[model samples]
Target: MVLLLFDFFFHPFVPDVLSLWHQEFDFYTLLLSVVYGGIIEEIMMRWGMMTLLVWLFWKVAARKKQVPPYAVFWTAILVSSLVFAVGHYSVTALETEITTPVLVRMVILNGFGGVVFGWLYWKKNLETAMAAHICTHLTMQAVLVISTILS
Candidate 1:
């Protein structure tokens, strides 16, 4: 996975990234993250927010067209991803101070996840995005487990 690659390649130089991701991980938290991050987030973000944006954009920009333009979809994806990235600031701020590096990290990483999920939702369905989100969490958890085992 991309995250694993980031960890594998950059972890030696930037070990703080691992710490920045999560301070604690247990079975319950992992389950909760998968459920909430995967199912709930996809529902709210892709299914709800992105869909809403697409509808609005389609209505305003391409009302007569049967299918929305690619630009509309990209606009919706970018906006929704922006919201998703900013939304993460709340949790990070609650945990610790939101420094410039933290802000950049969350924006790039979470925004990237949002875009991927949004693309899946647009191309496939809500379930596809949900599955991808779940897989992402599982992969991250697997990385954590592997690192814990190694160290």
Candidate 2:
């Protein structure tokens, strides 16, 4: 997908925030990061923020007694994703020398994840989206472990 491509290309450009893994690897540090950074952050961003925004929008729409089209949902996803990217940018800038490409990739990837979450929301429900988000975060932890072991 376009979003995926953009993310892949741009992620390296995003300034690194919190260089937790410097020089030799630390197993405990990785574990802590997986617990706090991966799990906690994913829950807060994808499930908490994304889901809450959708519900709030739905509530507002229901109050207006207007059932907007799926475009409304798409818009919400896009907006939330942008905000998420911006938040990451701030964090990244604080810790790393973010290049343009890194920032672009980070934004693109987050946006793509938002789209998937939005789709999950439409297909199954908000809870399903949260599950998907958590699964993705778990997978990232697995990736980190595998990479560390391999290298």
Candidate 3:
């Protein structure tokens, strides 16, 4: 809900890096983004990277325990989310200037969503996290389409 409101209100003030609808809206790109962003990102960030980070922490830091501690789990989520945010910037590096402000904005805005999805993946399941991501993309695409039509 907060994320939705953030998109509704503050999105225009932010850089296009954080905006959902970037280029001219095409159904194919929208569909592709929703599907790819939902599935592949979650698989990479949550299932693969986060799981590995947690397991590594468990192995090195908490060798006596069967599972990682809560602190380690949260560290994994945060680190993985930071990696996710960094990945976004890397993809767009050629187009945009990598200023401090832009980097901060990307980290905070996208990283917040990453943390939410990571938490959902940790607490609920991967499917739930993917659903949230898909819904987010779908909602943004719907808003863009409606606004375009209305305009």
lDDT of 3: 0.81
Global fold similarity of model 1 (TM-score): 0.88
> Tens digit of lDDT per residue, candidate 1, span 1-151?
7655544544344336345243345999799989999999999999999999999999999999999999999999999999998999887676657676667766777888999999999999999999999999988887778777666
- Give the clashing pairs for model 1: none
Candidate 2 per-residue C-alpha lDDT over 1-151 given as tens digits, one digit per residue, 9 for 90 to 100: 3443453454454433332112235567556655654456556665677667766777776546466456566666777767766777775666666776656665666667766766776668756766666566555545546656777
7 in model 3: Cα distance from truth in Å?
Answer: 5.2
What is each predicted model's overall lDDT from 0 to 1? 0.83, 0.60, 0.81
Better of 1 and 3 by TM-score: 1
Worst 10 residues of 2 by lDDT: 15-24
Error of 1 at 48 (Å): 0.4
TM-score of each: 0.88, 0.62, 0.82
RMSD per model, one decimal: 2.5, 4.7, 2.6
For model 3, what is the error of residue 146's alpha carbon versus the real structure, in angstroms, after optimal superposition? 2.8
| Predicted candidate 3 versus true structure: per-residue lDDT over 1-151, tens digit per residue | 5565655455566567555544357889778867888999999999999999999988989989876799888999999999998888875566577777666666776788899999999999999999998987777778778767777
Ranking by lDDT: 1, 3, 2
